[model samples]
Target: MTRPRATVVSLNQRIRDDIEARIRSGEWPPGHRIPSEHELMARYGCSRMTVNKVLSMLAAHGVIERRRRAGSFVARPHPHIESVALDIADIPLEVTQRGHDYRFQLLSRRKRRPRRGHGPEMQVAGDGSLLVLQSLHLSDSAPFALEERVIGLAAVPQAQQQPFDRIAPGSWLLQHVPWTRAVHRISAVNADAEQARRLQVEAGTACLVIERQTWRGEQPITYVRQMFLGEAYDLVARFAPGRPARRD
Candidate 1:
């Protein structure tokens, strides 16, 4: 009797799953080099094309990183960070969850008209005036994040009446307003002098910035820019293979 050959699809998935399992289980830690294509092909009794496809998929998913002439290795995650889900939550609640005391300090509040050169936050104000707020969030008395926000008076007129002294603006907005949609933009930047002073980090230190805009129906509600120390925070997202990500 002759031994049967495994189908290409089955073998490909098998190899991919095995590698993923090792990485997830910490058997292959971050920066651990993956087996070369030739080695994988020989071990799995598969074609070079199949091994390449598996590696390509893993790289695309961020499970591993490929370097020119250096082969592929397990990817390292950001250091000294707290991973968060896609759905951002209240900052005060986040600090409490981390077993730290949370405090808010309102820096400034002003009402101003939108100007052409101000930026997108100002543009969201349309023809109406904006209630601008600046605040800082502290964890265990240490600077955690700095926030700058502008609320569209036409959309959330009540914001002008409330003094955001004890509570952070983001936390207050989440409670009083019902938003139909929100968009988040994340980036990294070196701290400027003012931001460095507020965040208590070196001027040249890297910071993670999250800019968010929320809307009620077609009307803009508020726009906020939050800056956090890069090593102190991280954002994580999980998704299924072949599934489209949620837009909102």
Candidate 2:
């Protein structure tokens, strides 16, 4: 009896799986060029379209990088930076994933009523009090980022009782609170004296800052500003065109 041949979809998957396996097993390290599409087509006995689709998928997933004329290569790793898409990340987890020890230090904590000069995020508290926190995130005993945050007591009353000494406020809030919407603002700024001292960088060094505010419906939950040494961080966003609908 003769065995049945694999379908086109299976062939594409098999080619993709083989390439990924080689890269993962260290057989094909970062910057190692992958075989050309023609070679893959011949090796798999598949069409150039099928091979191209597999390569496109790999590039989309960051498993490989394609050059205009040099063909594809295993993508180099980014170990110190964190990437996110439409979600908040726990800083501690980000550090650990980069193969470093993570530590959080709470620099200060204060409870006070919102005042006129306190900033717009504070106004969200209305008549309620605010829990303000400043902290440091360290990776392998080196300064990673500095965080300043304010939690609205009216929205999260439980924040008042939490010490926030052992855990960073952002991580704590993500675990305990439910936020429906969030806005992020990214900018570059020269580090001031206080910021430079805390981050252990030279004064006037360029830094990347991310400011975010989250809300649950009409109730504001929290607002935070995080600063990092520019070379130590990166922000990445990926997009692809939507597929056309199929017609029956």
- The TM-score values for the models, in the order shown, are 0.62, 0.62
- Model 1 misplaced stretches (Cα beyond 4 Å): 1-85, 241-248
Report clashes for each candidate as comma-separated counts.
Answer: 0, 0
Residue-by-residue lDDT tens digits, candidate 2, 135-170: 999999999999988899877766877888888899
What's the lDDT for all of these models? 0.80, 0.80
Please report the TM-score between candidate 1 and the true structure: 0.62
Q: Kindly report which residue pairs in candidate 2 clash with one another.
A: none
Worst 10 residues of 1 by lDDT: 78-87
Error of 1 at 109 (Å): 0.7
Per-residue CA lDDT of model 1 for 3-89, tens digit only, reads 345466567667876887787677999899999999998999877888999898677646678899999998776453222325656
How does model 2 score by TM-score? 0.62
C-alpha displacement of 69 in model 1, angstroms? 70
Residue 246, model 1, lDDT: 30
Can you list the residue pairs that collide in candidate 1?
A: none
lDDT of 1: 0.80
